[model samples]
Target: MRRKAYDDLLAWKNGKTKQALLVTGARQIGKTYLIREFGGGEYDHVAEFNLATDDVTRESFLAARSADDLALRISIAADGPLVPGHTLVFIDEVQECPNVVTYIKTLVDRGEYDYVLSGSLLGVELENVRSYPVGYMSELMMFPMDFEEFCWATGLADQAFAMARDCFERQTPVPDFLHERLSALFHRYLLTGGMPDVVAAFVRDNAVDNVRTLQADIRRFYNRDITQYAPRDRRLVIQEIYRMIPGQLNNPTRRFKVGDIADVQRFSQVQDEFLWLSRANVALPVYNVDEPKGPLRAAEERRLLKLFYSDVGLLTGTYEKRSTLGILDGLGTQSGETSSSHDRMNFGGVYENVVAQELVAHGFAPYYFTGKKVGELDFLIEDADGRIRALEIKSGSRFRSHAALDKALVAPGYGIDEAIVFAETNVERDGKVLYLPVYMVSLLHRTRQLV
Candidate 1:
């Protein structure tokens, strides 16, 4: 998997006062595999349990009176003995029993063993639980692989992934071959969608048809999960929202409107479903950042909000756009014809989302910025140091948006340090603004030197 989250687990393991850890992500996003692979290799003895199975084990643990006693019983229930320094205890699907979170806090306070907890429906489960173990658990979010990680993991570390870090860091030109390959790979990623199994299969076979089959299987899993978890009436609304994503993004505004769902639908019926998807971690709602302040909350943005799926693959899978990749990958036609079609596909939306994915991966949650009278920026990322950087992504060859950048830079009392433009050419500064190619977004911290 080659995940950065694995490194987070390592830090928690070595901490002087480590808490019980919770690993959260969507189903089939490799939360379980990450823990097993990283834990098995790093620890002496790994004791794991799946709360979805074995009712007796659940009852026994829940019946315990003390955290120390519960830890001992959980170890015994897992068919292993607790060895504090040697064993790393893992609880999978802990959301099936949210009270276990309390027990985990007790274990952290009293027991000597290190613990790793993981679950897909933790968001929904948290709603049912009394309180979260805030101070007692370190949370590690495991999203689907980003494009660079996917490339490295699938034995296809092309020029794009290799140059991205350097492009943004040094503000240097990317090799021509790398840019072309990245453009191609960017299209491929849109189809395969960053699920580990799908990517592994795509790289192994080099067959788009096989990738489509895998995506369909994953889509089936998601549909079934929604049917089981979401309310019966709202299930259809959720499906409608999922179906509307691609077309909605194709709009110029890119903000989801209820009318975009179809010819006949009310926002009242679908808003709750949108919240449900957010709660299930199926989608991310990027609120408009009006104030551009610390902890940019929903209040900062009055009316605008955009929604994105957690993984592009799931988006493609659920939307039944598996054929879009065929046009993207230069397949099923004469060479010249395929080239023109590929160029027309204009991989912009996927690239914009890819940039968003990497920013989230780097520990910053991005918000979209727009104003009724002013203008719009594609992304606004606030770093740990309280610096809010505005990012504008342009996948096209032409560099526009200078006017919008000017408006954003001098809007009211906001201090825009320097704007970042991700495009094809490295256009030098316009006063304090910086123009960088899309390939360099991952390395923006280094590009900060230009500011």
Candidate 2:
């Protein structure tokens, strides 16, 4: 499968001042796969070492006294020679031996072979490393396949994505046929998500049930990690927080309330657990900004926040607990199944979550605004030009603006001249607001660049 991160790896590899690269993301999001793919294709010789599974390799690193010694041992361990400029040395599961991270400084100082290190728990484990090779390491964050990458993997041509980008740049509705096709594809993406494993399975068999099963297994793996890595007493708290994500998102306020899952009256008591999930890349938290401005994070309300699962497919699998293929196929409600009012509410949350995912994938820090008298704006975004824009996400065709968005657009302090509404509607402009179909959310970052 194609990944945008691959291009980043290439840039790092070809840079003038090269540093050891550290690839970080949640487990199973393809950090390992991407590094290996880059190494196999870009290097004449690839020395791959996985510390998690290779005890001998770990022992060699521990025994080495110098970069040259470590290099020789790693070359032997990889059953290959590490040549300068032509070889790529990849260290997988570096969290298992955090000390290995510090070795990057030595390796880079020696200027022998190019190095790439990857770990699922790098953020958590880095705390214990003897020293962080601060200047010697470059980091790239990997995320689940975005919509464009998903399109590439599923046999859609690059031109298709280009066409979508062109439409977004022009602020025009896509041709009806392409819009319908993309809408159907986006629905499948909601269920299959950008998880490479789930996407590959669905593409191969065209079975939503199989994808759901894989997603469930992925969830189990994450739970197991919490149990295995979290402090013994806090494991249950972390698990409770993880399980409450779907319900929290469904709340009308769209803020994660610690009290909803636990009996805690204060967020500080469980704040570390929330941080743990975010650091682990299992949850993406959107903070509440009291004021919308250039430095949005300055006025963040830490106590009020929304947490979204890292992948929308996993969220759907956990929330729906059944195959959504029928729903995607126009069979609204399946026979013999009764969906509650809460289930109906979840549809909006799911749509919002997907928009959040797309925004995050494109390097936006998700923030939202709730006004006492004006109403709520689903998201507040700052474009490349440092302009704050209000984004409202609507799940259905009945698109209507709230006073908060209108107020933010024209308010003196807000400085937001235009607002964007993402809904099941075609692209159109209404006064200062632009109405766009939900799928176009993925094109937002690119559209900003064009503007």
Candidate 3:
């Protein structure tokens, strides 16, 4: 039930940043719950509004003239007094009223109360701002429960996580007992995924059927969002692309081909739909990079990319039945044996998607690299220091023979010092490449770039 984002909120309040706070994430990603928790604990009063469900407030927002007018209109709908310096004015579902972003500056200048907003589709709907609210608002992007946060929800102690972190930093292996336990939890995470309600259900009752039901409901909710929010002309296409994500990742190259979705040849044809899914916070696109270098953005081959679900577990749910057996069935087998079997079982894409989600949660913009001379590299990211690090996600024990990774390290001008391979194996090293247990990805957080 705990979230790493909770700490981010606490820091924002304690620091008195003075900017209107906006928390953006996919629906059911706990944006409202966490903000409510903060408002209750930190303020004497919470003047909260939910724009999506409150019809009167939605109409009032449209009719309001200025920050003062909007504040008064919203305050009339709030539960309690809006006291200066003692209240948190929380606005939820701002996607319904994107103008809230424009008026937030005057609201902050009023100096009446601390402002906070939560919304999905901020990426898609908050276009009136010209840019996504710079200088006037502080934005935080949230995602599903990562492995470490999942550990806390599952009641794994601080001491155990500290042990795993220490071993990872020191380049040592975890003990047999704790290693197996964490590995099992990682598989369970793959099975349950990170959606808040689904994770809560599994933790509260050890029922897999209930887990699948909640996941199904979440997917249906997203489908409804497409119907309600997506452009009228493209709703069907968006839904079709969303459904194709699981099958696309299951392909050998893991590249999402625009041509496969329709008879189209160029990415321009469906680029908006792809961007909509990403901006709506439901899907993730890891574009291909032409070179492995610093400032990975400059090298992006935007047309070529791999698409993954925002939640790995949600991706698993699309498999129709007994998705749990696919991931856990082959654990602890030799790396090579698992690799071959994973192809048949459709687990490779799931593992890759899990790594993509973890890297993103830890503040890395993931990309893949490939060429005729070099082989296929799974993920490449810039670290806190802006150095390039190559990552390979191994679904099984055959982790030793990575042709692409080996070539990338030795290539001239790459300046790559070491590589990371997150496999179902204990921590070990072969020269410059450090192999880590998949569960330790929780510790790979790049916690820098604070202003």
Judging by lDDT against the true structure, name the best candidate. Answer: 3
Name the better of 1 and 3 by TM-score. Answer: 3
Q: For model 2, how does the per-residue alpha-carbon lDDT over 237-331 read when each residue is reduced to its tens digit?
A: 99999999987776676689887766788898998999899999988999888877767878798888899999999888875554343436323
**Index of the highest-TM-score prediction:** 3
lDDT string for model 1 (334-423, tens) is 111223454244444555666766676566677877776567777887766667788877655445555566787777777555588876
| Candidate ranking (TM-score, best to worst) | 3, 2, 1
Please estimate how well model 1 matches the true structure, expressed as its whole-model Cα lDDT: 0.68
Q: Rate the local accuracy (lDDT) of all candidates.
A: 0.68, 0.79, 0.84
The clash count for each model shown is 2, 0, 4
| Colliding pairs, model 2 | none
lDDT of 3 by residue, 1-451 (tens): 7898888888877775558888888999888998998888888999888898988888899787777899889788887887888999998998888778878888887778899888888887886563444676777899998988887889999899999999999989999999988988888899888988899998999767898888889989999999988999889889999999988987777899788876668899898999999999899999998888878999999899999999988988878665347566444232235333443464678888899999888888999998787788899988778888898888865777788899988888775655999888899999889999888877887873223
Looking at candidate 2, what is the lDDT of residue 226?
A: 94
Off by over 4 Å in 3: 130-133, 329-344, 448-451
